[model samples]
Target chain A: MDLQYFAELFLGGLTRGSIYALIALGYTMVYGIIELINFAHGEIYMIGAFTGLIVATVLTFAGFPTLAVLVLASVAAVVYSSCYGYTMEKIAYKPLRGAPRLSALISAIGMSLFLQNYVLLAQTSDFLPFPSLVPDLPFWEPYAHIISSQEIVIISVTALVMILLNLLIKFTRMGKAMRATSQDREMAMLTGVDVNRVISLTFIIGSATAALGAVLIASHIGQINFYVGFIAGIKAFVAAVLGGIGSVPGAVVGALVLGWTESFFTGYISSDYEDVFAFIFLVVILIFKPSGILGRSETQKV
Target chain B: MASLIEIRKSFLVSIWFMFLTFPIMVIRVNTVENVIQWRWNNMIAVGLGSFLLSFVWRYLIRRKEQGVQRQEESTGLRRSIFQRIGEDRRIFLPGLTVAAVAVVVFPFLVSMYQVNIMTTAFMYIMLGLGLNIVVGVAGLLDLGYVAFYAVGAYTYALLNYHFGLSFWICLPIGAGLGAVFGILLGFPVLRLRGDYLAIVTLGFGEIIRLVLENWNEFSFGPSGIANIPRPGLFGVAFSLEAHSRYIYFIVVILAIFTIFMVNRLQNSRIGRAWLALREDEIACQAMGVDKTRTKLTAFALGATWAGLAGVVFAAKTTFINPASFTLWESINILCIVVLGGMGSITGVVLGALVLVLLPEYLRAFAEYRILTFGVVLVLMMVFRPGGIVSNVRRTYQFEGPDSGDK
Candidate 1:
């Protein structure tokens, strides 16, 4: 492939990877703490995107400044999705605490189905065009042909969020409590950490990040649908697992790898089997290294 | 934590929830007008409903605490009632016999439309029973079980379409292919367990569907193979109303056969090994159960029944498509097995009937049925993880004739 084409593909992959990274963070965080795949998380992201759409529409109609509109919509989306994340955990997952692993997983799946269909019933299933509210930055014109302003925004925003998240987890008290709880729940509780609060906080932050991702991705892709969550959720899950599921940085790296692989494969090969390639990669990775590239291999204690 | 009434805090949380839900639930885009519209009524309803839910939840918790004080008084009465049923055979055996007879004669008593619905329910029972072997008995959570059903269905469809094979001839062939595909998909993931296994199987299912959709020459792609021949006894075609009766009879027999085989397996050595594997993998391996062989057996056996159901399904519809076999179908069958009580034969039957019939009855609420199905799944898992009819573990006694104390 030519250099320009390859760079373009790389840029596309990076943008897509950032979106996946956003969703994968939620899965990894929830799994790290509870050891349960939060299957409904993707739905939270979808809901966030829709919320952002509505917020942006309202703000635009009110004739707000472009910058204010974007900022407010994003904030509104995050706040709304975080509440959904909290309510989801409270209603579907909280009651099943300490139950069999499968029971909780099943509950997550049920909640996922409930949310997806609920959205379908509440809103039109057809793809709705996302409002192009992103302001054009003059500095990006030189690289505009290779990388659009939107792509740069997605990438820069993702980097900022990841860095902030890293700082929050490392320096904050809630982060320490989350870390302690994930490592050993009972011990954390004994040490005066309210595990429940930590867990709820995890869901809130994880979901907020996902909402941020949804808004960025919806703007980038220019369309949104109710069923977007199912496939996107699964792929991000694949990214999480590929990067060693419980590790946060691993999720971001894995998502980038998945995105690049998909971009090149679609660019060079056929685009029809893009999803097939992603899933096949997941299965192959699972077979060779079930713990993932960066995951700590669990030793059977017997 | 110490307060009896935190009115301010509760009110704050409620208001916070109201704000969170307000944007998405209360306001929506009116596409024609291209403006955001307020759904104030929906906003108020949801806000009130959520507040009520929180209140009721606290009330239940309080009641549970108070009820604990009286539990000692009721324990004796509850124990006596349970023990009586445990020891009793007169009430159980006769009831089973009567229920069996009613099932056999049900089609004759019902109208054709009802029979058609009942037939569909029977197919689900077979699918649920088949999946029960993998998920319930063997303790492998297979999320791609519908793939096997698709294999069985396509096997029959292709055979009949290309080679003019009879349904009877194709039945066993489809089942054999189903087992082969089961083993094929089951092998790579044999080393994995729990969530990993579930995800891989899901991948395999998706791969199958994608291939079927893309490979136009072999499977006819999305348009699907139509006018597939039905299963017949000798040369008689079941293409009329009377033929519907025959189809119902065949389904009934197949369902019974599946239940019988599954029940037998549950009491056999294989069943014991599967149960052991489910409870603990390391312990079972240490005790001498061959892990790979046992798991493959469960997969192959489970796939066999799904294949059988697929053949029947193709015959009933007289058409086949990739759309007929989707992830939703797998979840539906899984729900039946779960709702009925995993590892419980009677529970599977009850689950199949209720899940299928309830949706059919609520025809007007068709779109809402799936929403309810999702709700039911979450509620069932949270409240009754064992299912509606939890299986009672049986113990055999090696006693002489005088041991018949009942």
Candidate 2:
């Protein structure tokens, strides 16, 4: 492959990976905290995009500047998504806390289906043309052939998010409580960690990340529909699993790896079979390395 | 008593929900034209609706808590009504007779349209029972059960398309192919944990569908194959109405056969192995259940039924397409198994009828059917995880000395 073409594909993979990482972070965090797949997590991301679209559409229509519109829309998406995540946990999952893992999973699937259809019922089912919110910087116009400024923004924002998240986890009391809860829920409660709040906070944070991803990707792609979440959700879940679910850093690495795989395979092989390749990759990985790249192998004790 | 704190709590909830629903519900965006349709009424409705619904929500939560507390307080396990009716021979015998009579006479009395719907319901009953083997009995959360169904459907469609094979011939072939596919999937996934298994299966299902959609020369792509003949009787061509009735009877017979086989399997050695596996995989393996064999059997058995149902589905519709078999269909089948009362035949039958028939009849709200299924699933999980007809555990009871072990 030519170097220029290879570089383009690499950046393309990075963009895709960054998006997957954004969503996979949610899955990893939630799985770390509760050990449930949080199947409806994708729906929250879709809702984020829809929310952002609506807010942006109205704000722009109301004569707001593009920058103000972008910031406000992202904020709205985050706030609404966090609200949804909190409510979803309280309504669907909290009651089933002591129930079998399967029950929580089924509920999550149900919640996912419910939210997808809810959006379908509330919004139009057709693909809505999302506005391109990222403006290209004049200075970076020369290298735009390889990577657009929008992509640059996405990568930088994702990096910024990761740094902020790392700092939060390392320094904040809530983050410490989250770590404690993830390690041992009962012990954390015994140590007066307010486990429920920690759980809610985890969901909220995860959903917020998903919302950010949704808004960014939606703007970049320039269109969205209710069905976007299911496929993207599954892909991110695959990334999460690939990185050995429940590990945050693993999620990023896994997403990037998956992104590269899809990008290169589609670039060289067949675009039609891109999804098939991803799934097959997942199945194969699961078969041989069930623990994932960064995940520790867990053993069950009776 | 109208409690002020409760009202205040509900009011806050209403406000939160109103805010939560504001953008999506209130603003209708037409991106094509840049026009915004602001429906202020939806927000008001949400506010009012949530305010009222929170009372019911709290009441249900309170009642659920009380019910759990009561169950804990009681030393003895209280049987559900379905279980009680099932165990009492006098009641069970009569109920069975009545149900049998209804099944026999209902087709004759109902319109052809109703028969068609009933046939579909029976088909779901079969699919649900098949899925029950993997999910309910074996504790494998398979989200790709429809892949096997698609395998069955496509097998029949392709066989008939190429060889002019009859339905009677394809039925077993379809089922066998489905079992083969199931085994193929089961072998790799047998070692994975429950959730991981679910995703892999989902991936597998999507892979199958995508291949079918893209591989035009192989499966004819998305336009689907049509004009496939229905099940024949002695090389005779039946009228469309007759075909519908014939399919109904065929489905009814197959559903009964499925019920019979599953019932027998329930107490069989392998069935018990599956049950043990569902309860605890480690314990089951430790008990020398041969986890791989039991899991594979469950997969094969489940897929076999799906295959049978798949052939019937293609024959009934006289068409097959990738769209017909989606993850949603798999979820629908899973819902039937779970909603019916996992591992309970009666429950599956009941669940099949309600889930299938309600949607069929409610044509106006048909659009909302899936949305309703989603809600039903959440509600069912929250309120009654065991399902509509919870399985009854067989227990040994000692009688008085005179009637000891009677």
Candidate 3:
């Protein structure tokens, strides 16, 4: 492939991978804290996308300027999704804290089904077109390939979110509490660190990141559906597992690798077999390194 | 002498009475619709026959319970009546007899639509039984088992469509392919336990489905293969001219054979090793059980059964699509094994029948069916975490012709 073509594919993969990384962080965070699979995490991603779409539409109808409306919609989506995530953890999962892993899994599946159907009932099942808020620039036209303005926005927004998340988790007291709770819930509770509050905060952070991802993805794709999260979620989950499910940096690395693999497969091989190629890569990786690429193997007690 | 004579007469009378009443009851129910059409003579005869049969059935059931209690008391076993009845071989006889009768008469009684539903239910039963061997017996949480089912289905479909092979000939081929895939899957993640293993298996299942969807040259892409051949018995076609009743009978025979094989496997030494692995994998390993071989065997055996079912399914539907084998299908089959009381053959069968028929029966509800189904599943999980028939233990007896040890 030519250098320009390679660069385009690389940029494309990076943008998609960033969104996946954001969602993967939620899965890994929740899993780290509770040892729960959090099957409804994908649905949370879906809710975030819908929330953004709704806010954007409402803002546009209110006669707001494009720039102002975009900013407000982004804020609304993140805040709403965080609250939704908090409530879900408190109500559905909290009661089953002491239950079997299988029971928790079943509950998560039930919640996922409930949320998906709820969306289907409330909104039309058709894919709604998401309006592009960013202005198109022609500077990249001279580079021998067309680059959409949305793609640059997606990459920048994702990077901004990731950097902000890293800073918050590294410096904030709430982040420390989250780290403590994840390491040892009972110990953290005994040490007077409000474990429940910490968990709620974790959900808030994860959900907000996922919402940001939703906005980016909606803008890039220009269309959203209730079922879009299903495939995206699975791919993100693959990313999470590839990077070692609970590791933050691992998720990012995993997402990039997955995104690149998918793009390369579609480019080199048939586009139809992209999904197959990705899954086969997952299986092969799991067989060779079950702990994931960057995951640490911990001893389990019977 | 008088007491002995009285006992013999009572036993003979009860057996003869039960035999005489069964057919009369069936005939009476059959004629009730005719009676509703202003047939006075038929109504009177049916009503009288129904009443007599009801009285006989009630009396016999009551007497059997009483006899069972007396026998339990006389046997001098310290177990309670419930325990004794569970342990008794005779209890299974009644259920088996009822199932046998239903299998025989079902095609005659139901429409072709209903028969088709039953056929699907039977296929699910086979799938559930296969899954039960892995998850239920061996206690391995395999979330990607649908991959093997897909392997079997696609193998049979592609081969039969391209090679024009007979459906029966493809059955073993499908099974072999499934077993091969099972071993391949089992080798990796052999050390992974619980959630990790489940995730890997889930990935494996997705991979298989994705491959089938993408491989257009071999699997015909999303359109899938159509007009597959059907299974025939000794060159006897199961076409309309040959009658669908014969096909129903054939499926019934397959179901019985599956049940019999499962039962035998459960009671054999291999079954014990499986139970051991389930109860404590470490201990089983320590006891020289060769955990790898056992685990692989479980996978292979389970996949093989699913493959056999796939062959039947392809022949029955005469069309195979990628949509037919999806992750949701795997989840549904797993739900059957879980709902049916894992490790319980009869429970799995009952679970399959209920889940398959419940949706059909709730057709009036339409959109609400899926919601209700999900709710029912959640409720069932909450109420009976171990499944409906989980606690029922089976005891096998080794009784030779000369050496009787009961």
Q: Tell me what fraction of the real C-alpha contacts between chains A and B each candidate also makes.
A: 0.57, 0.71, 0.21
Model 2: residue A291 alpha-carbon error in angstroms: 2.0
Clashing pairs in 3: none
Q: After superposition, how far is residue A138 of candidate 1 from its true place, in Å?
A: 1.7
Candidate 2 is scored at a TM of 0.97
Q: Best to worst by lDDT, what's the order?
A: 2, 1, 3
Q: Give candidate 1's error at residue B1 in angstroms.
A: 16
How do all models score by TM-score? Answer: 0.93, 0.97, 0.81
* DockQ each: 0.64, 0.71, 0.09
- Write model 3 residue lDDT over B154-244, tens digit each, in one string: 7778887778777677888988988888888899878877766777888888878877787788788789888776676777655563345
- Encode model 3's per-residue lDDT on A1-302: one tens digit a residue: 58777777777788778889989889888888888777778878887877777667666666899888788878877887787688678545775676556656665666666667656645547777777766566675564255566777777777787788788778998878888888899999999899988888888888888888887788768888778777777888889888888878888889988998888788767787787788788878877888888887877555
Off by over 4 Å in 2: B398-406
Compared with the true structure, model 3 gives a TM-score of 0.81
Model 2: per-residue lDDT, tens digit, A143-230? Answer: 9988999999899988899889988988999889989999999999999999999999999999999999999999999999999999
Ranking by TM-score: 2, 1, 3
Cα displacement (angstroms), candidate 3, residue A103, comes to: 2.7
Candidate 3 has an fnat equal to 0.21
